[model samples]
Target: MMSSVINALSVDIEDWFQVGAFESTLDRADWPSFEHRVERNTDAVLAMFDDAGAKGTFFTLAWVAERYPALIRRIVAAGHELASHGYDHQRVFTLSAEAFRADLRKSRRLLEDAGGVAVTGYRAPSFSIDQQTPWAHAVLAEEGYAYSSSVAPVRHDHYGWAGSPRFGWRPVDGSGLLELPVTTARLAGRTLAAGGGGFFRMLPYEFSRWAVRQVNAEGHPAVLYFHPWEIDPGQPRVPNAPLRSKVRHYANLSAMEGKLRRLLRDFRWGRVDALVEGMTA
Candidate 1:
């Protein structure tokens, strides 16, 4: 049976070449040279959501919005919440406090201008906000963001702020801004990632379904996310990239759409904004 609880679904609006995995190999200056596939993949995602009658959030990159203004408008028109995924998908810990704020401001202005909606939520690129970036939540609050989904509560070489609260909490003292960590489930004394990403693509669909059910049974909404590129197997291959990056990026592209459809039908999916409202209320 499908869970009655509404879990938060999110799509990180980015292209395949723009991923952190290809950063070292692909220069940001040459992003325009690559074939842009985000629009087609994102449109496919929107159609998937429409078919399932589900609503979710699109954490958009201002870089993409600048090039694809019509795509941003299409997302808004489909009733999905629009949020920021930073100006160009820079890791939060990589930038100084002032630079981070500037990135946030730039992203918000572009997204709002392109989509014609108030952008309140944010998801750090690559889930990069952690203890080292203590000023992150404060910066977010100062920038007028109401909430952020930037922390992943699992250990990983690339990014993860392990031991953080599994659900939402005010990361900064006295700030109303909420930091909603990606969903995680405890299994046999070990914490496992229940949220989406490479793990979702690499692992079996049944495991993800089980994880969501476990989290829902505990009475918390599971916050899951994936990139628009995850569903596009035909996306250009980056053969020169590291083997690990290649595996993570291309492991199960063919399976993602089917798994995602099952996930949507198995749970009541909604936008992150609604989940934030409930948590704050």
Candidate 2:
């Protein structure tokens, strides 16, 4: 009944120019060179959802919030949920526990201060939760997050927990934090990207629609997510990025916004925390 009431869609609010995929060539310190940030792009995403009368979660980087307080306020003003996407865009698995703690503490503080709400959800940058960092859930619980959308069930070069369930569930480890893994489907004994991130951008619109349907049919809320850049095709490019990263970042660029618009219209979606609380309550 809870799943029937709403769709659980999320947007990772970051600039097209600020992704970690280009970290080697374009350091975060070099962010000053880019004229565009998440302001107008975030507004565009908000407007897209608004046009569909959709309310969803925004897992914003504290890095973005610190630079654009008014934009953070605007997201709240428009009736979306606020959640953390880390303080910097660093991958969680690579950070030691202490370092990760610092990142979360800082992000939680800034996100709550700017957003004017308790941020109960966290999605790691690049979906970087894996077996190597299963302890991150306990850390999240310690940080007061009630749920996480960090784990990607699909295998990828940078992130993914292969064979992890694709739907939301309370952790068997008793961390008291619900794990809402990004959408995935099993194919040939491996996890395939059912939706979200660059995969969501690259896949055919019909395939995404079908994937969500399959996940929902199994009685879990379809947790779809995307980045601001995925829709902002005109943003500056990182030409020095490795060829593979370049292809992933730039593929199907112009067509993404339309696919997202269709998704908002076709699905019954809502904020991530709202759906979780609604389901468990």
Cα lDDT, model 2, residue 238: 74
Q: Write the per-residue lDDT of candidate 1 for residues 50-82, one digit (tens) a residue.
A: 999999999999999999999999999999999
Would you give me the overall lDDT of model 2?
0.84
Extract clashing residue pairs from model 2: 7-268, 7-269, 7-270
State the lDDT at 277 in candidate 1: 96
> What are the clash counts of all predictions, listed in order?
0, 3
CA lDDT of each prediction against the hidden true structure: 0.92, 0.84
Native-structure RMSD, model 2: 2.0
lDDT of 2 by residue, 258-280 (tens): 88888888889889998888766
